[model samples]
Target: NSKPKDTQQSMCTPVCLGASGMVHVLLREELLLKEHILKTIILGQMLSLFICGTAVTSQYLAEQYQVNTPMFQSFINYSLLLLVYTTMLAFRTGSDSLWQILKQRWWKYIFLGLADVEANYMIVKAYQYTTLTSVQLLDCFGIPVLMALSWFILRARYRLIHFLAVAVCLLGVGTMVGADILAGRQDSEGSDVVIGDVLVLLGASLYAISNVSEEYIVKNLSRVEFLGMVGLFGTIISGLQLAIVEHREIMRIQWNWKIALLFTAFALCMFGLYSFMPVVIKVTSATSVNLGILTADLYSLFFGLFLFFYKFSGLYILSFVIIMVGFILYCSTPTRTAEPTALPQPGSTGLDNAALKLEENDSETPAITVQFTRGEAVVVSTD
Candidate 1:
């Protein structure tokens, strides 16, 4: 009787232990999956914030430069500062490198050159006419326009929540733009700032187009290679403007060491920023990319508030809150698919194999076999 009882107990032990092990493995896996999802989301948020900061800072610097272009030009001490930067970059990089990239990505360089030159010139011109706040407020239109373009042209499927969020942002834009218009009219000088606003709008549209175009460029080139090309092209475009618009002024300009230093700092800031923006987009999602731009707007507004004592009225402040809340509502909605996940074709192993390997016990038991026989037997067991 003791022998029979002992045998029964021994038989139950392995069964009970196996079941417990399976349960433990499943729990661990669930925890890991949850952790991974949380990490991805957090990273997305951080990337968005970082991108925004860079963008805001760049705009602020541009505003500063606009205030004193000739002075800014003098410090750089070139009749054509844009050309100077381009020439410097070209010389620094050497012809061989530039030619190699031109051969591979000529069209992309053209787009970058066009966008950069237009964006820079417009922003500078806008700042000379309208307030920084006005330029930024008008620039808000870019985000919505880009989103619409991405949806319609790029066929980027967005959640309904995203559209609602954008709608909220548009309302904010209307309020701010409306405020700027009223404020402009009340100004004693009464110069036509409308041109400045329109220029900014055009710049905004170009930016949207460039940002989308970059997605393709990144696939073909290294980050360094792409940015170098953009900077080079931007330099050329600016050089032409310097030649055409301010050549005589530039020739008569006297160098100011202090201003030159400031210009250098500003250029460095832009270089760092533009380089990082695309990289951030690559690491994160497009929504995050847009979020970065929005954040930058807030940052720029805050900087304006600090530097210029730019005050926001009750309506503008209210609009800001509503837009942000709408964005939060949209961004917080669960993504059905985060980044695109590649699926294996028929006859190839699927992600299930990878997912299974992530199991803790399976990791420890490297000899475990995943058996999938033709049309019938599918088993995962220790070999």
Candidate 2:
């Protein structure tokens, strides 16, 4: 028993203790961030604004251009998205050789592409069957749904206060949607709000899934590879779909300069927004990222009111406030657990240590001796 304790202590020192020390600091920083009411409020506002604005722009493009093909729209959206992310990666992953960048983990791109592609397609299809406001109502559900998934499936932990905050924010958002629907502001004639909601729900679900998947992927992949692959794959899928579905319409339509400018602007906005989102997530917590984006609703609201002249009932205001509150609550309540770092086992050479040594030496060195607690030792050399 005494010997076992000694061995345990020896193994625990650098591995467990060191790990705990580093993690404790990180956890503290995360907690400190949580305590700051100002940070959460500011971040939430920013995120919401961006989200709203982007939605408005998207809806405007769809309506003005009368683009009917869901797949084609998704393709175009992603093509632009790919370009944006690529440029971001170039700056973020500076000095990484192109070959090396390609070699980096790429599952992230796949996940992003899949989520985005599905979201885009679902949105376009939903719009065909419903109104922009209706589609938005359904789409906004993604935030809460995302929280639930993150909590249960991802096993992310949160405090009670955080949950309460999320509830408030979600309630506000719900109010807004309810208000819109009750005011006879649903999508155009022949478009089913029910179907649109369902489609949007599906799209939201996919988006939520992608968020979780992105966390894991980001841990392994470089930004370049992640976004590059997404752009490349999404472009291919969208292009094929466009070729089959929109070829005739595209050829017949007049290429107005205004339309071209709008499309370019839309593409640029999308690429830039998405490209920056991950960086924001990395710099802060997902909660901050989500809540900060709550302004998206407000942006949409203003767009609907002014740019599109979309009418809303008093109920719309109530619903919007409720949903916004709910979102705030949702974001305020932490759902994701900080990822724990893997530590080397007793008697095992640390991967980090080995890599550092190799980088420094770059030589065929003699065998490095590794000893066990029982006084037994073994030597393994490296090339």
Candidate 3:
């Protein structure tokens, strides 16, 4: 009888130990999730502050310094990226060399580079025609466009909570806009508000494209590759555009230490934005990054109070808080994995299917392949 009791006690001990271990694991996982959320929030705001820095510097250049060279400004940023990231990429050793990557995907990077370059130019140029606040707020237009692109192109699926969070963010934007109207600040510093708003919309759309592409590249490929390719193509494209569009403006600028410092500040801020953005996007979705950076407008307003002598509105504070709440809500939930979708099969010709299978198997090492035909299908296979 004592032996039976001893055996029962031994079994009970193992069960209790197993239960304790499971609880510990669950608690640790919960703590890790909370920590990750906190880190993402901090990183997102840092990016926002970097954006604010760029905006403030751009506005100062356009207003006080009378510098309206958008292409030239972007050119500097891209050149810096090329000088830094491209160089780093050259030294990186892996399955493919730098030349191999460029040879294989040069066209795709060109598209990305063009979109990125123009987006920066348009937003910076809008400062000449619109108030800083307008530029900041209108940029949110990209969020919806980004979501749509992600849904189709990136195969990202959103949850009901994500939609709710987005709604909350847009509501914050509405509150801010209302505040701008109440404060009689809508037309302030804006020469042609309509034109500026239109430019912002166009730029925001382009930004959505660039961001979604970046998200895909960084997640599937390498962050260094994305930055390096963007840098290389971006520098070349921006340089050509700058020569055609802003050469005269660049020549006419009255050079001074103050002006030089502002330009340097802008380039550094932009470089920082580009370098760190991939890290954030890799951890979170492009949509979350865009939403997180919405606070950039408030940061700009805070600076504008001192620099532009803008009037303060309480609604702006409320808007900022609301946006933060929405961002937190969105980040609390993990992004869903890309849902499986039907891939386009080979054409009626058996040759196409045979060739596709061969290519797919060859590229299996990287686990991603881009089909140039059939609407540029991206097939990702994982182990």
RMSD values for the candidates in order, in angstroms, are 9.0, 10.7, 7.0
Clash count, predicted structure 2: 48
What TM-score would candidate 3 get against the native? 0.84
Each candidate's TM vs. the true structure?
A: 0.60, 0.67, 0.84
Ranking by TM-score: 3, 2, 1
Per model, state how many residue pairs clash: 1, 48, 0
- Could you give candidate 1's per-residue lDDT for residues 235-350 as a string of tens digits? 56666666677766545545577545555655554544555556765654455466434534544455656665666556657656666666555555544433343632325544
Candidate 3 backbone clash number: 0
lDDT of 3: 0.87
Tens-digit per-residue lDDT, 1-383, candidate 2: 99999999998888988889999999998788576545656655665655565566666656787644446545666777567666565555444543445566455455567676777677667767767666655676776777677676556677777767666765566666666666566546545767877888998788777665554445445555555667776897678767877788677656688767766665655666656566555555555466556557656776788788877567656655665555555554445464544533445544323211222243555544443433333345444
Per-residue error at 63 for model 2, in Å? 4.0
Instruction: Please give the TM-score that candidate 2 achieves against the real structure.
Output: 0.67
Note the residue pairs that clash in candidate 1: 74-77
Best by lDDT: 3
